[model samples]
Target: MSDGARVIVGVSGSLHSLTALHRAAEEARARQAVLVPVLAWTPVGGERNYRARPCPPLLRAWQELAEGRLEQALGQAFGGLPIGLPSQPMVLRGEAAAVLTGLADRPDDLLVVSSGEQGGLRTGLRRALRRSVARQCLKRARCGVLVVPPSTLHEDLRALHRGIDLRELAAA
Candidate 1:
């Protein structure tokens, strides 16, 4: 841990998350804080299901996969961890919002997360159906919460994925 300040960012390897990660890196650099990028995961099934099955090998494999994802997300965001910036990457097993809020339990820490509101109706519906991580962090974080909105590129990518014509959106 850094002596003075810490910037905690939730990372899930999504484009929105990567945008938040980049913003968090910028915040860390400006504040001279340690950057803590966290990727949270759960078992294939819910915790109840996992408890019933209790397969150690599968649990280990899932943890390894989460580790890989954290590395990959960092690489994709900065080609690797940002040079000249102090970073501690973590792969924890829990719900994303809970793990992030739990780690950001400091007065001076800053919690960064995506708004998770990009894409079309399906995306909106999906987020509405669940408790959004960003919303949860905003509500529960002990530290300052920075909710990064989805970048234009992320929205464009989502539109492209849905086969929507960009020009039509532009004209509208």
Candidate 2:
């Protein structure tokens, strides 16, 4: 895709999600597009009865701290770059895939998501949900869907790029 396109990435509190966010930002820079870091959180199975919905002092303080951290991280990631595309963080309230599909209204936009956790009894459940969401997102998104496997992109799990000169590329 061309530079200046919109690339929206989904991130949670997990390290995997953060890795994906970093990769998404890098990809957006390479493509000369704007990076939209979407931090999506769901409030435990959507089971809120809306009892008053008043902000407790502690909760408000915690939320304020969280927002500050997010803004700081966004600034560090996007602002530190010398001459790259713009990146902004957006907080979304919903399932990651559903929100991505819903937000992707233009063909120029690209959605990047982590494949998800692997290996364990609960692995099956995670894979199932990921597959379902991936299918829906790939079909629903107007643009492209980058379903990144955890092993392929994350630092703890990165494969060496074949025939690539990192020093030359960096200088370029």
Candidate 2 runs further than 4 Å off: 1-4, 45-48, 51-83, 127-133, 152-172
Query: Candidate 2's residue-wise lDDT over 1-172, tens digit each?
Result: 4645888887664555666667887778777788887765544334263233644574556445556655655655555432556766676656667788888668788898776665656778877655655567777788888876665433323223344555655577
lDDT of 2 at 141: 83
What lDDT score goes with residue 55 in model 1?
Answer: 97
Residue-level lDDT for 145 in candidate 1: 97
Give lDDT per model, in order.
Answer: 0.92, 0.65
lDDT of 1 by residue, 46-150 (tens): 788999989999999999999999999999999998899999999999999999999999899999999976657888789778879998888899999999998
Worst 10 residues of 2 by lDDT: 152-161
Please report the candidate that would top lDDT against the real structure: 1
Residue 80 of model 1 has an lDDT of: 90
Write down the TM-score of every candidate: 0.92, 0.65
